[model samples]
Target: MVQMIFLFAILALMTIVLMEANTVSARDCLSGTFGGPCWAWSGEKCRRLCIEERHVSGHCSGGMKCWCEGC
Candidate 1:
């Protein structure tokens, strides 16, 4: 019974922590594809283009797509 209560208390604390952590302010960013396709796309290149050209943050995501986030 004591162990169960301890476990429950820990779980409740974790839940509260997670809830607080999840309440972060999200950026209102615009997302779109960068270049042609994933075949010749690199993270550095994409990030550079996004930062320099579009003035935003960018990354090469899955499926060979360069995702750019503009605020």
Candidate 2:
């Protein structure tokens, strides 16, 4: 019973955290393929583009994909 209560409390805390996170800002994610140099499509580059587009952050992923994130 004690363990169950603790688990429930942890779950509740996690739920609250997630909810607060969503309330902070909603992000719009855009992903696209690039054929340029790897450095040209780096995570920092994508992040900068996102920032220019008034976004929060961004990253370059596998398969030469650039993920731009905005709020």
Candidate 3:
């Protein structure tokens, strides 16, 4: 009986944690990347575009792409 209770508690905690991780109002995990060096723009410029598009985080990737996080 005690072992069953402990397992149930663990499972409940895991469910709550996963729910928090996949929040609906804000994307806590979803992310993507896009290649750059197009239109005579630098990677930094492309990163700003990602930010403008509402990414939670954005960065220039190795002078060739824009990497962004959040949705």
Candidate 4:
């Protein structure tokens, strides 16, 4: 009897967590290369340039390119 109650409690908690997770807004995680020539592979530099010029979040991608989100 105790084990059954514990199992039900765990299941309820899992259901609540899943429901709450689904309610949150999803991000446009897909990023694409943007901006002009980027010779150096710098995350901070690329993010700064992207936010300065395009007004969006960005990161340094492979091949020393600046990839921006929602671009």
Candidate 5:
């Protein structure tokens, strides 16, 4: 029973870590200058420039830039 509990605890920890590493928010895009839309990725911030020849969605807040897909 103790071993099972330990295993479960480890699994839970791994799950939590993975989730955090993969977690990302749209705010990252609006974090700094660029003052333009961007594509956010898991464990990564928005890209500096648009990848495709498409209109990205973004906003400028407090002189900062924020962006998201299909914004």
Candidate 6:
């Protein structure tokens, strides 16, 4: 039982470390465009954009350009 618990704890720690090391890549806002905005919630990542004029929210890494419409 103790060994099982220790194994679970180690597994949990490894999972956390893996998650923290993971990073999401930027998405394309406009077609033919290479870089755009990217959003990451938990371990998943997504690409989002705003039509017309609206406020958009997203997350990106360093040296990445974050684009949004409106204010």
Best by TM-score: 2
What TM-score would every model get versus the actual structure?
A: 0.41, 0.41, 0.35, 0.38, 0.35, 0.33
Q: In model 5, what are the clashing residue pairs, if there are any?
A: 30-65
C-alpha-based local distance difference test score of model 6: 0.40
Query: All predictions: root-mean-square deviation over Cα?
Result: 9.1, 8.6, 11.5, 11.0, 11.0, 10.0
lDDT of 4 by residue, 1-71 (tens): 99999999999988876764443234323233355654545667767766765646765433445655555
Off by over 4 Å in 1: 1-34, 39-41
Model 6 lDDT at residue 23: 39
Better of 4 and 6 by TM-score: 4
Task: Give the Å error, residue 19, model 1.
Answer: 21
Candidate 6 residue lDDT tens string, 1-71: 99999999999988866664343334323212224443333112222433222334333433243433233
- The candidate scoring highest on lDDT is 2
- Model 6 ranges off by over 4 Å: 24-71
Give one digit per residue, the lDDT tens place, for model 5 in 1-71.
99999999999988876664443344334333343433233212333232231325432222223443442
Judged by whole-model lDDT over C-alpha atoms, candidate 3 comes out at 0.53
> How far off is residue 13 in model 3, in Å?
0.0
From the highest lDDT down, the ranking of the candidates is 2, 1, 4, 3, 5, 6
lDDT of 1 by residue, 17-50 (tens): 6764443225322235455763343767777766
Candidate 1 lDDT for residue 1: 100
- Per-prediction count of colliding residue pairs? 1, 0, 0, 0, 1, 0
TM-score of 5: 0.35
lDDT of 1 at 50: 68
Candidate 1 matches the true fold with a TM-score of 0.41
Candidate 6 clashing pairs? none
Q: lDDT of each structure?
A: 0.58, 0.59, 0.53, 0.57, 0.42, 0.40
